[model samples]
Target: MLTREWATLPEFAAMALPGVPETRALQKWAISGNWSRPEWRNVYWRRRSGTCGAIEYSYQLLDRPAQLAWMQRHVVISVEDEIAAFGDDKRYADEWRMFHEASQTKQKKALEILQHLDRLHRLMEAGHTLEIAIYDVCREFGLKRTTVMNWRRRVKYVCRHHWLPFLLPGNKGATGPRAACDEQAWEFYRSDYLRAERPNHSDCYRRMVAAAEKNGWVVPSAKTMQRRINELPTAVIKMAREGRDRVKDMVPAQERDRTHLHALQAVNADGHKWDVFVKWPDGTVARPMMVAWQDLYSNMFLSWRVDRSENTDAIQLALGDLVEKWGIPQRAYLDNGRAFASKRMTGGAKTRFRFKVREGDAAGVMTILGIETIFVTPYSGQSKPIERGFRDFAQGLSKHPAFAGAYTGNNPMAKPENYGSSAVPLETFLAVISDGIKEHNSRLGRNTAVCGGVKSFRQVFEESLAQVQPRKPVAQQRHLWLRAAENLTTNKKDGSFKFLGNRYFGSFLNDHLGESIVVRFDPQDLHQDMHVYSMDGRYLGDAPIIEKTGFDTTAAAAEKKRAEKLLTKATKMRLDAEKALSPAELVALMPDLDEDGEDLVESKVVQQFRPRAVVAGSSALALDCDEEQELAREREEMAEVMQLRDYL
Candidate 1:
């Protein structure tokens, strides 16, 4: 190694080693540099102590004047000998990597040339002439004279360039200047070539050339056009030709923000029409709709329900299952569907609605349960997170071999050859769906959000379970979870209301006679007693069925007897309360009775309660005559009853 002492030395006169070409050459190269002795020594000292900041090369020590002097100076050093003595520089590691990873054919030829150069260098070091060394090396390596000359030239090129042969351009020193084409013309040609119905390279080239000729512009050959087309990025070309909907998936996607979310914190519900046809129980074939709820944070599907058509009932059923199995979600993101927006799902808000809405309806199911509902934009499937799970389900389950003939393509134009030829049974479809759902939940690597580093949806959901703060539903209010329907008129006679063609009686409805009240009931099974609420969601008592006659001998009789007993007890209680009435009030109930037990005239108590007579004229004589006539009529009417009613 060269030390600071040698680097700062004024001349080689004091340290002469004439026989050592390497030493003499280095001394000459150093002295030729325009650095003052102290400056050169300072550089070496800094490098030796590792105090220089990011300065790797010896050339960095020279200023402008020193650089010019050093470049112009005549100096001789065995480049190969110095490289061998100092070993390879780690600073050029990246360059060596590029060389080793070069094309296989170029690497092989470069290695052969390097071996020849190494042999020649050794021969020269042993004090042999160039011609003699080349002859000896060629004989030893079994190479032709011209080949030896080519290898020597390759060595000289590497020595001058300080780069391997493989790292150089493959077509170096070949042919004339490259072919050229107008850039604007090429861009237009590329656009036309990469259309949905793409054109061939040869055709594009021909069209471009014709256009160029007409415009008096130069155009390249077809081969050049083909190479340019190949150079275009595959993904960009696919996007241009195939449309974004088809090729967008090929591009990398970013993970959604779910930092503040936990399992069951927010859930998304959406409906997907399955691609397979199934034989329904009614002997008709149809595609079933799947209403699914997925956790936003964990990517786990909480629950799902299948039906011939998606409706509010199905949505509630799916959500109910989710709530029961994996606690209720704090917030629910729902797609803008007719079923999801139905009053039963979202009708319970008390505030004045901005959209056309029904009045006097109870809070929506989500509102009743304390779950915040967010309605996604209409027709925007990407807005809800559950859509991705449906895509995965279609790929995993709907394409099973059991549904081969029934597998309808997602798009009409993409249907299979045997589409609609056969139908899968409903039971079989349901069984397959169940199995598929299990497998989907268990499949690993779905936690792309990296929540707790879990690999599967189930694992991710379970891991985040502790972070959930769920609002539990009360058991008493569980049945009221469905949507409320239209209001009905309460019967004034008995305070009973008609619902689904059945009469229901509730004592609480007595005060709300003739008023319109909203009724909420399960559409699927109206057999359960319907819940009644006031126009303002006040809990009115439940009404039971008024009549039950068919196929009920024992139960009906028992219910009737129980009703009669309650009625008798109520009558006794009323009679006991009436005992506190005064004698005059009690006498008001009895009137003069005829022998045949009939009263011919109105009782005085009843007559006093009637409205006063309106007179046609208000003269004193006329009033006196009318009064006398009324007294005479009363005497005439009561005379018969007075004679027959001896008890009075």
Candidate 2:
């Protein structure tokens, strides 16, 4: 398309004047009209190749109609049309590879041969004999006639078109010996060398040689075995030597799209134990586990709790804080850890595998609040987004200036020189963590999908929050996550139970005394009331802590008095209601047995009894005087033996 810079006399004549088909007639007309003048804006001339004389004219010198004709004749409408017009073939795939690998001189020679072939094809297309075409190409390219024929013969059988690759000089296949080792020897070497134990190549070669000597097989050299190992695919070698998990890790991980999620719509939770040492309130030094919940959409750290270790209580409280402050999330991506899978958090989930699933189990906080719980793969950090945030925290928070001596490296082997030299107080550690978390959320230009590398996480979260209505749990619903659940039985005597060293009692518990019920309470605040539920998940009532006092204290006396008053009031109410119906009135209220005027039903079977006779007698006692004296002496000996037995 208007690509040619210049056109010859015959080309210009055929394009500019369709009527003047003869080049000699067009030249005569141009001379008679004197069209070569500079003011005419036509017939601009350019020197011919390898000649001082002008032979071509610029296409711009033609009139509008002639230029249009030329453009229409040569215009390329599409890129594919242009490529197809060049007759480019796919065979160049191999040709270019061989050409690149060949020596510089060989590469130059291959290009020269390709140019000669182009000319030879053109000459042959013009009705010249093959020999004559080859001779002309050889004469023009300064090559021998035999050399040109030999290049053509080299590609004659295999490649009919795009035969530049086959025409390349030098060995086209692999070099060196073909059969270095037999199948049996190769198999033995592979088995010995490509093991999970990963033996060295030289050692494996020596072992293979020893085995070859005994088996009468030919073995290859150590270098040859090493080369073969290198030729094996990396994945295959890794699978054989490094194990399946290592090979699996080499594969790219799946990416998740969270563009549709909004703030508080979904969140992820995980526990990370900080490497920095802190002195706990109990006077013990240890690394603290921070259970954190992050908003999935904005990647913002919504809430967190620090404890001596990861536990159900810490996770529950952290989730509670998240719900209380930012509203309830629709879904939670959690770690497959015992704390995250606790019955208190995910009790009734069908996918929960940590505890035994049972019928009529109390629903967990997530189940009660209608939030979906998704457990990530166990021990897989990539499955949870919070792990990345925790990594960032580890880099900044753990290495803070306030924790200089207390900074313990991520692993034992990476510990700093001053590790264990000192420990920060728990209060100071918490304060620093609070400041760090604030700064992390408020930092500008968060390079996340939601932030678009322009806004902070807090800004992104708040913007989304403004556009969506997140579920907000009321005070009663908040207890579902804020409190831990336990199946406990109330005391049979007073309908009260001991929990966390405190006695909890409720008047409603009197009806459920000695019966198993679900009790949910805040572990951090034992003084607050606990929410009670039946085993079948029905809310019973709240049980307040029964505060203790000295027996002689006025408070104790007042409490006793209050209890007595309550009992008296309850008994009076019951008695008054009962008295409303007198004994006779109650009897009258009962149904009369003879109202139908039917005879009483009798027993069908008879019970038999045996008769007994009784004899009554009052006989007078009489004894002789001699007999009486002997009886008196026997009685005295009996009395002495009784006295000795009593003394012993």
State the weakest 10-residue window (summed lDDT) of model 1: 1-10
State the lDDT of candidate 1 residue by residue for 1-648, as single tens digits. Answer: 112122322232233323222546545654576443665445442333444542222432433233222322322333243345436655444444455456777766665555555555645654567887677667656778886665455445343234344233342321235688888788868988999887777787788888888887777878777867766766778877787765756756655688567888888888899999999999999999998898888778888999999987888888878877777788888766678877666776443233467555545667666788887666655677678788887786889998989999889899999989899999999999988888887887664764445488888778789666666666655555553455788998767888778887776776788888767776776667678876655567676667757653666766766876886798778778978877898788888556887657865664336677877665655566778889999999898678535522
True-structure lDDT of candidate 2? 0.78
- Per-model C-alpha lDDT, please? 0.68, 0.78
Q: Given candidate 1, what's the lDDT at residue 354? A: 35
TM-score of 1: 0.54
RMSD in angstroms between candidate 1 and the native structure over all alpha carbons: 14.2
Clashes of each: 3, 0
Q: How many residue-pair clashes does candidate 2 contain?
A: 0
Candidate 2 stretches greater than 4 Å from native: 1-177, 221-224, 230-233, 491-494, 498-504, 522-530, 536-538, 544-565, 571-648
**Which regions of candidate 1 deviate over 4 angstroms?**
1-23, 28-254, 349-355, 378-382, 444-447, 450-455, 466-469, 482-484, 492-494, 500-502, 525-528, 535-538, 546-648
Q: In terms of TM-score, which candidate is strongest?
A: 2
Screening candidate 2 with a backbone cut-off below 3 angstroms (N, C-alpha, C), the clashing residue pairs are none
RMSD of 2: 12.9
